[model samples]
Target: MSSIRLFILSSFDLLGPMHGHRLRIEAENRHVSLWTEISVGAVYGAMARLAEEGYLRQIGEEKDGKRPVKQIFEITEEGRRLLAELRRSGLTEIWYKHDPFDLALVRLDPASAAELPALLQARLKALEERLAEADRINAWAAPYIGVTKRAALKHGQHRLRGEIAYLREVLDDIDAIVAEVAAGKV
Candidate 1:
């Protein structure tokens, strides 16, 4: 299932009949780009694809002054069914991957140990900033959202905290490893 497809169908389901331009705006307002690989241009392309696939039906078109006309769309019954399926899959699926960090760490050059600590320290600094942002979001959202939603927000923060802790340990180990490499002892 394509995330862009799911996002388009879900947006129509929630926002009622809307044009692609409006959908793009709402998607940005909701911060969909932050967590997903979907681009702003992809929204229009997904809308076209969804329409081609019979999931979305264009109700009509509207034009304002000299601007290009906008095609208004609504979800079909099949779209609703697909949306439910996608939502269920999203909740139940665990997407595991070997991250780039692991690959880079494994490929680190012992001869370049002098440059490695600064690189890792830069990554550590980034992780720390991410952790801080996650904490801020969790704190800010806790009061207004439901228990489950709040827990979900905290889950992100918790993961960041764990990553930060792990990175700290790695940073500490980096110096020792660099020393050992410089001494030709390992």
Candidate 2:
């Protein structure tokens, strides 16, 4: 239903038509980085959306006494098709995929010394936008802080800080490279 459909289905593809608890565990086992709190809501929403789109079908019963029933899901034929397409679609050649990081490095191969500064500037601008977005999310989640935030505020802040640091390091590296290239060193 959304861009996250791939992750949602892949999570299911790995776990099989399991209910929430099982899927959560499987996602964690597969990617310890996934916080169940954040991922559960996302995966659940994605699953429901996919079901409405006929990409998935209920497969089993999961009644837990007084707790809400969890409906198991199975990949529909359409889901399989969609998954395959998502997996291989980048290869068709009509248009090549250019992820942000790839594009940054790819352009470095042919860019002139003058162009390097501008390109690095553009990349830094993009990084700034991302950091700004992360900051906004962290700020909004501040009220929930450690308790109600699905992901801990500290964790989110730390993750954002890591990203910011990585971006800054890249920026520094590019600046040094540009200086070297301008001086006929690299």
Candidate 3:
């Protein structure tokens, strides 16, 4: 389901009359439970917040045998306009991807590049520490994870160790290449 803060409000505008209970039922019918305290808070909070923003309003009320009255809510013209603006802006299609190592490389100034060996060495040292920490974790979780996940977690743990070793090799090769180039012998 869409998680944009406006998702529920927009759906109510599209679908006819909808209250929190009806919304929960509809969402549950689609195999999604929308009744958690967090969800209830967000939904009622969004509805009230939007109403204050002049996008929605409490229009009617219904009562169930064992509960307080349910206040039905509906979207206003302002809410429709807001949704239209969002649709026009294509907010749903936007995304971002980031890579930490590539980001550092991109931000490297010439001074930093000249000092790259020390920086990379520091990074490699940190990685070694992390690898050791991961090994400790693996040891601690070995019995429980082995029993629960069988060969899967163990196989994945081995692969993780292999990858970390491979990263060490790559870092070493990078250091050598950098040294060679700095010496004008490459």
Candidate 4:
């Protein structure tokens, strides 16, 4: 199941009937991009697709001021059922992606030894910055978000911290690593 589909369905289920623009605004307000695959701008297309699939139905159209008419939508019973299935699958699934950095490290060439250290340092810095940003967002959102969202924020921070720690260890052993690579042992 797609996270975007889940997000769109859940938003409709919880927030009642809303137009695509409103849904997009809600997604942006919730900072869904930070943790989920849902793209704020894609909500319109997803809503249209869901309506076509019978998961959502267009209720009416409304025009506010000079703006064009907006088609409002509400979730169907099928959407509710689909949301439950999506939640179940999402909660039960475990995913781990292989980082390309691992492959590059394993294939490190002695000639690139000088570059590896700087590259690793840059990566470490980026991860550290991400962790800091996560912390800031968590702090800002704590008052408005529930425990589940807070947990997701923490999860991201934890992952960043783990990577930062690993990078530190690699930096500490940089000399040995370069030597091993130079000897064609890595």
Q: Candidate 2: lDDT over CA atoms?
A: 0.64
TM accuracy, model 3: 0.45
Q: Of models 3 and 4, which has the larger TM-score?
A: 4
Task: Please give the distance, in angstroms, between residue 80's alpha carbon in candidate 3 and its true position after superposition.
Answer: 0.5
Candidate 1: list runs displaced more than 4 Å.
33-41, 141-149, 179-186
Instruction: Score each candidate by Cα lDDT.
Output: 0.82, 0.64, 0.62, 0.91
**Considering every candidate listed, which one attains the maximal lDDT?**
4
Total clashing pairs in model 3: 0
Which residue pairs show backbone clashes in model 4?
A: none
Instruction: Report the C-alpha displacement of residue 41, candidate 4, in angstroms.
Output: 1.5
Clashes of each: 0, 0, 0, 0
Worst 10 residues of 1 by lDDT: 29-38
Q: Please report, as a residue range, the 10-residue window in candidate 3 with the lowest summed lDDT.
A: 29-38
Worst 10 contiguous positions by lDDT, candidate 2 = 32-41
lDDT of 3 by residue, 1-186 (tens): 234434666678778667777766655553222211125335666666777888888899898898999888888888788878766664456533464876665555544557776777787677667567656755765665536444434544565576567656757677665555566553
Q: What would the TM-scores of all predictions be?
A: 0.82, 0.45, 0.45, 0.89
Model 1 clash count equals 0
lDDT of 1 at 153: 68
Tens digits of per-residue lDDT, candidate 1, 41-150, equal: 78998899889989999999999999999999999999999999998887788756567987666655668778878988898899889878877766776776678666
lDDT (10s digit) by residue, model 4, range 32-88: 988876778998888889999999998999999999999989999999999999999
Q: What is the lDDT of residue 123 in candidate 1?
A: 86
